[model samples]
Structure formats: C-alpha cells, structure tokens
Target chain A: MSQYELAVILGMTAVTFLIRYSFFALGDKVQFPPLVKRALRYVPVAVLTAIVVPMVLLPDGRQWQLDWRNAWLLGALVSAFIAWRFNHLLAAMGGGMAVFFLWRWLLA
Target chain B: MTTTYHPTRHGELLQGARDSLPMLAGAAPFGIIFGTLAGPSGLSLLGAMGMSLFVFAGSSQFIALTLLSGGAGLAVIVFTTFVVNLRHALYSATLLPHVAALGQRWRIPLAFWLTDETFAVVQHRYGAADASPLKHWYHLGSSLAMYGNWIVWTLVGVLLGRSFEGLDKLGLEFAMVATFTGIVVSLLKTRPMVAAAIAAGAVALLARDMPYKLGLLLAALAGVVVGVLLEGRNATEEGQA
Candidate 1:
C-alpha cells in the first residue's frame, strides 16, 4: 500500500530472482567442492527440522509452555510414530488428524 | 538396465499422475486455502489463478497474495516472493546432475515442472542402481500429475471463494501447519538428523517474532550449523573407535 511496502516487496522479488538465477547462471561454470557438496546434503534435513520443530513445540510463543490448547505436539508424535512403524503417508496423516481432533474435543 | 521399460510420453504422464497422489494430497488442500484466502485479500479469481500458474509455490503464493491484498507494491510482492522461493534455487541445484543429460529442450520443461515431491522421487530414482531413461519418465510423470493437481485444486478454491463466504475463518489455516509437520516428521530418519531438526526448531521458536520471515532463514542456518557440528563429532568418534 505504502511506498515503503512496495519497496520491500520488490526488493524481496529481486533477491529471490538473484538467488535462483545464480544457480542456472553459475552452476555450469562453478564446481562445488567436496566439503560443500557434503554440507549441502544435510541442509534440507536441518532446514526442515527448524521449520517443523518450532511450529509443534512453541506454536504461540517462546514461553515453552505445553497445554491442551496446542495439539500440534501430540499430533506430531502420533504422526511420527505411525510413519516410523508403518511407513505410510495416509496412515500418518490420518493418525495425526485423529489425535488432533480427539485432543481438541476432549480438552474442550 | 536403464533401457528396459522405457515409458512413452503418454505412459509417463499416466504414471506421473498416479505417483503424484501423495503430493496432491497436501497440495490440493494448500492450493484451495490459498485460493479461498486470496479472494478475501481483495484478489480476483483470475489474479489468484494467475499467481498459482506463474509462481507455482504455495508459501510464496500466499505471501504474494497477502502483499497484494494489503496493497503492497509490486516490488515488495516480487521481493518477498523471491526470498520465500529462494529454496527452489537449492532444490534446482541439487537436482541438476541427475537431469543434466536430458538435453536442452526436455531439460527446460522438466526443470520448470520440478517440485519438492518430484525432486524427492527423481533423486531416489537417480540414486538407484539403474541407468534407465525411463527414470526421467517417472520424474516427468509424477511432476505433470502434481502440476495438474495444483491447478485443479487452486481452481476449486477460487470457485469456492467466489460463491461461498465465511469459509476463511473456519480454520482451514491449521492444515498448513499440519502438512508441514507431516513433511518434517517423515523426513527425519536418523539420530543426527533428528538432533539437527530439534536444534533448528528450537531456534525458530526463539526467533518466531522476527520481522520479514527471518525466523525461517535463521532456523535453517542454525540447523545446518548444528548438523555439521554433530557430523564432525561423529566422524572423530568413528576414527577413535
């Protein structure tokens, strides 16, 4: 809406394009070293963890308080356990949804 | 070994559809949510669909939609979308070697269609002890299927948003978190991986309120650092053993 907001949005777009374009533009020219390659292997796992963990553990804030209102932690556990044992996506999702719904109902 | 069962383009499309079911499962809901919310944010169905078609990434689309509704400038929208979609650069880079030999014509389309699910499937097929070109077909098949699913679901959301009201506050937003949790849990398969995930998650929690989605970037950095540290320690222990 404001000029400042416009600047931020456009700036983000430029940065994103720059990041993506670098890969295509430089990928053929640049050779990644072995250490960098190995490190890249772990990036996804780490990034994903960082994204998921906080959402489950501290849904609202950094208070670190766990209560019935936030069913994310329980749902995550249920899903993880099911996925570990059964190795099925539908099953894990279903288990999580069921737990989350049940937890919400019981707590309510 | 790679030559056996070379799938025709049609066959690849069919297979891509079937293989994309898991991706579609999450994609459909997310796409719809994006659609439903975009309308309330002052975007038209055409605008929303156009965004989906062009951007093709859910989070970035949502960010763009929010910026648009809030009357943010085009520059801001583009910049935020770029930052949010930065991960795609990493994704494309990782997938480059596997798809390199496909030649320029096929390479462009294939690269364009590559999504997270496609990347995972393609990476697995590439790693398997097979040299078949049909593996590319598998990637193609799954990607096209996901592409269709995303378009269709986004359309549904647009239609729903146009006709129905009051669906936004029905709490469909939680599905996003649920989907992310599912993805993260499934991806964590090893002890060090799990530890790194926890560390990053903790960091994200601490940095949740940071402006401009810095939390995600910081969390990713923290996770990488923790994983590298753990890996180094493990290597040393193995050497000592």
Candidate 2:
C-alpha cells in the first residue's frame, strides 16, 4: 500500500476510536427528555433496516436487481420469519445459513 | 438528587475485568474475522490486532476494508465509515441510564467496552428491577470474556489469515447482518417500530444507487421521519378523542 493509504487507514482508526470514546466522555452528563427518549428507540430499527436491506437486495453492487440471483434476500426473508416466530438469535442465524447454503447447492 | 458511588483502588479493576469475561464466547469468532480480513488489506499483523483493540467495531472495520479494497478516495472512505458508525451514539445514549450510577472513572472504561453485545447484555440487566448481585456479576463476567475473546482471536486472524481462506464461504459475513435482523425483530414490540423499519427499508431500496453511502443516510432519515410523524399523529388523535 502507498503511504497515503497507510495514513488514511490510521486516520480512520483514530476517528473511529474518538467516536466510541466520546460517548463516555460526553454522553453521561447529558440526559434526554421523554420525547427524545422515545425517538431513540426507533434508531436501531431504522439504522439496522437501512443497512441490511440495501446489502441483501443489491449484493452485486449494481442497480437494484430483483431476480433469482437474490437468493440471499430470500434466505434473509425466511430467516426474518423464523426470527419473528421463535425470537431466538441462534435459530434465525441457522435458518438463514441453511436456506442460503441449500440455495447455492441446488443452483450449482 | 445525586447519589455518589464510593471509590475503589486499582485492585478492584480486576474485578471489573473478571466480570466482563462471559461475553467473550460470542466475540471470539467475530474478532477473528476482523483480524484475518485486515491482513489481506495490507495491514500488518500488529496493525490488524491494533485495529481490533483500538477500534473494536466490527461493522465499521469491515466498511473501512470494503472501501480500502475498492481503492476509493480517503475522504469518501472516512466519511462513509463515520456515517455507518453514527449508531454508536444511539447505543451510548441507551446505556447512559445504567452507567450513570457507576460514577465518572468506571463510566469511561465501561463505555470503552460498550459494543453491541455488551450493550445488549448490560441493558437487559439494567432494565430488570431490583436485580440480584448475580446480574451485575454476570454482566461483568460477560464483558471481560468478550474483551479477551476479541484480543486473542484478532491475533489469530492476523497471524493465520492464509490458512482460513475459505471461511468466507461459510457466510459468516452474513451473520452480522442476521444478528441485526434478529435484534430488530425482537425489539419491534410497538406500532412505531414497524412503521419505522418499513419506511427505512423502502428508502434504502429507493436510494440503493446513491454514491458515498448516501443510501444508508437517506434510509435512516426516512425511518426517523416516518416514526416521528406516526407517533405525533397518534398522540394528536388520542388528544382529540
């Protein structure tokens, strides 16, 4: 890697650490109101949805294609269903992996 | 009213470490992935381990790696990763209520280890009213375990990235997303969460082609907007009725 790349990576590492550490340094002193408290509850669901949906839907890093190639999405959907039903992390993970592997094998 | 916690000597810190050990079980494999992947990006063994020790965020590290592999601009990579990790602010806020009682010194170190696993375990304990001493002990044990698991597996990944070449085939990369799905599924106990998730997913799909991680930002903003609007409408309707 070039020196610039090395410097960039190091800089990122520092920035990430600063963000994590900032919580302890500043978050403790501040208390949020009830409305803001209620708002925070939605954050994880929002952020997680935003992150997961795009990746599963567009894994090839192109225009959003809706086809059988998106077996990953199907696998994720099935896993979501299992998770909703069982409310267990291990079960959800196992179900997704099972469907994904099964799809890959059948197609191959 | 302010309640002050009594201070303890440095020896007591070991108790804190011992308390955090149980969480290592989940973190071990996760850390290994980070370590192994870091080397392929031209990071030295020490560099990989240092990233895990200092950064300690699996998703952000992976995001950084993706940008590095793509040979994207440094500014873009940094900006994207920063946006991706903005959720840490939310996690910190969620955990503040519990650690507020720990006082200042313990607060900083406790927050340092506040990964998703740590926050989940700690928040669960915090929510339980009149928790037994065993609860805190369990959390402390888990946190320490997670920390050790992270450090050791990171070293292993850095040193042995070549040997475990096919680990990606196992789809462990998807496990991180799957974990988030599981959490989202478990937490959607109300109408607003349902609306918010759908809104976010829709925005993400719509903005899928946006560059520089704008899709994620847009999706998150959409979710927040939808949630706030829905809740506001509900409150107003309740008042009128």
Candidate 3:
C-alpha cells in the first residue's frame, strides 16, 4: 500500500477508536444538560433515518427516484409494512429482502 | 419500581446475548457485503480484517472504503468517518449513568463494543426495573456478541465475495434498512419522537449534496433540535395547564 493509503487506514483506526472510547472515559467528569439529554433520545431514530433515507430516495445522485421501478422504494415500503405489522427486525428484514428480490426479478 | 429482578451476572450476560440475536441477523448481510466490497475496493486482506477488528463501526468503515477507493486523502477519510461515527458520543452519554458504577474493566470494553445495533437493544435492556449491576454484564453480553458477529460475518463476506459476484445487485442491503425502520418505528412512542424522525429524514434528503457526508450529521442535529424544542414546548404547556 502507498503511504497515503496506509496513513488513511491508521488515521481511521486511531480516530474512530478514540471517539468511541471518549465518553466512557470522561463521562463522569462531564454532565449533560437536560435539553441535550432530551435531544439525545432522538439520536437513534434520527441517525438511522439519515442513513436509510438517501438510499431509497436518492440511491445514485442528488435526486429522488420517485418512480415505480425504484426497487429500494418498493422494498422499503414492503419492509416498513412488515416491520410494523410483525414488529420484528429479523422478520422485517426477511420480508424486505423477499420483496426486494421479487421486485428486482419482476423488473428484470 | 426499578428493582424487580436481580439477575446474576451470568444470567444477564446470557440474556444479553439472546436479545442481540434479532439485530445480529439484521447485520449479517451487511457484514458480508462489507467483506465482499473490501477486495474490489483495493483493500488488502489485512486491511479488511484489521478494519473490522479495530474500527468496528459499519457505516464509517463503508465510508472509508469508498473514500479509499476514490483515492481520497487520509485527513478527509478520517474526518468523514469521525463525523459519521460521532453519534456514538450520544450513545455513550445515554449509557453513562447506567454503567457508571462499573469500573474500568467493564467501562473500557463496553465503550469499544458499543454499536447502533447493540445500543438499540441495550438502551431498553438498561431499563429493566430490577436492573443495575447485572445490566453491566448484559451490556457486555450484547456488545461482545455483536463484536464477534461482525468479525465472523466479515470473514464470511471476504470468503463469499470471491465466489458470489451479484450479491450487491441482489438488493440484500434492504434487510438492514428494514431492520432499522422497525427499530425507528418502535422507538417513536411520542410526538417529539415522530417529529424527530421526520425532521431527520427531511434534512438528510435536503442536505444530501453536502460534502464529506456532512449531511448525515446535519440531519441528526436538525432532528435533535426539533425534538428538544418540541419537548420543551410540551413541558411549558403542561406547566401552564
């Protein structure tokens, strides 16, 4: 690997590890405000949506793929419905994949 | 009310492992895809394995892999992944008081092991009325189980990548999306929660063109701001009433 590539790897390893380790080490020393604490409750839902939305809406470029042929849109709906109806992550996953595959096959 | 069942450390650990199974299954395909993506992206065997072994954060690793392939600089790669993984600070803060009594032995390892999937299960686990000390073991159980799962699945992905060519095209990643959707919906027990998710999705979409995946962070911040403001407003309304 080149120096640049090696540096990127090592940098990632160091930075990510330190960030994950920080609050545990310094948590007691610092206390969060009630406002911040309340907001923290939304972190998971927010972060996950932030990650998942762009994939279904704009998988490729900077625009929404609001078409019927959008596999992600179709599969996400199937997955979201199954996920809600079953309230099971694994089942929702299975249902989503099943729909996604069928959708892809049908499109093909 | 917080002291109902006091499970022994062993039981908590075992329960922790069992509860993590659903998220584990959700993550399985993701791990495999990451492993497979590593090779064609010019990552060496050591690089792929070392990343999973060390960083252990999925989205950041995926981002790093993409940047690596694109010949992005180390600074950019590090900064981007750091922003992506910054949400862990929120996880850490949320978990702080629960694990406060545990010493460094528990704290250090659990900190390293924390992940979105593990936290999804663990935050609720920490709330079991009879939970306190046993919760630490439970944290260990869930985190370590996920740690092992990622490693094993990444290995499987690395191996499978060679033989399976069309896995990405197979739309298998939707499983993770589906799993996340389930987690998101389940957590939306309040109006602020609903607003938070909507704000996040909308902001993420709006900020999609932001460089270095800053859009993700912007979206998260937007959600938190909206949720917090709504929460404060509700508190004031209750006081007035």
- Give the TM-score of each candidate: 0.75, 0.73, 0.82
Say which docking band candidate 3 falls in.
medium
Model 3 reproduces what portion of true contacts? 0.68
Error of 1 at B60 (Å): 2.3
Of the two candidates 1 and 2, the one with more favorable TM-score, higher being better, is 1
**Candidate 3 clashes between residue pairs 3 or more apart in a chain or in different chains:** B2-B129, B4-B130
Task: Give the candidate order by descending TM-score.
Answer: 3, 1, 2
User: Which candidate should be chosen as best, given lDDT against the real structure?
Assistant: 3
- Candidate 1 docking: what grade? acceptable
Which candidate model has the greater TM-score, 1 or 3?
Answer: 3
Ranking by lDDT: 3, 2, 1
Best by DockQ: 3
Question: Which candidate would rank higher by lDDT, 2 or 3?
Answer: 3
The candidate scoring highest on TM-score is 3
- Please say which candidate is ahead in DockQ: 1 or 2: 2
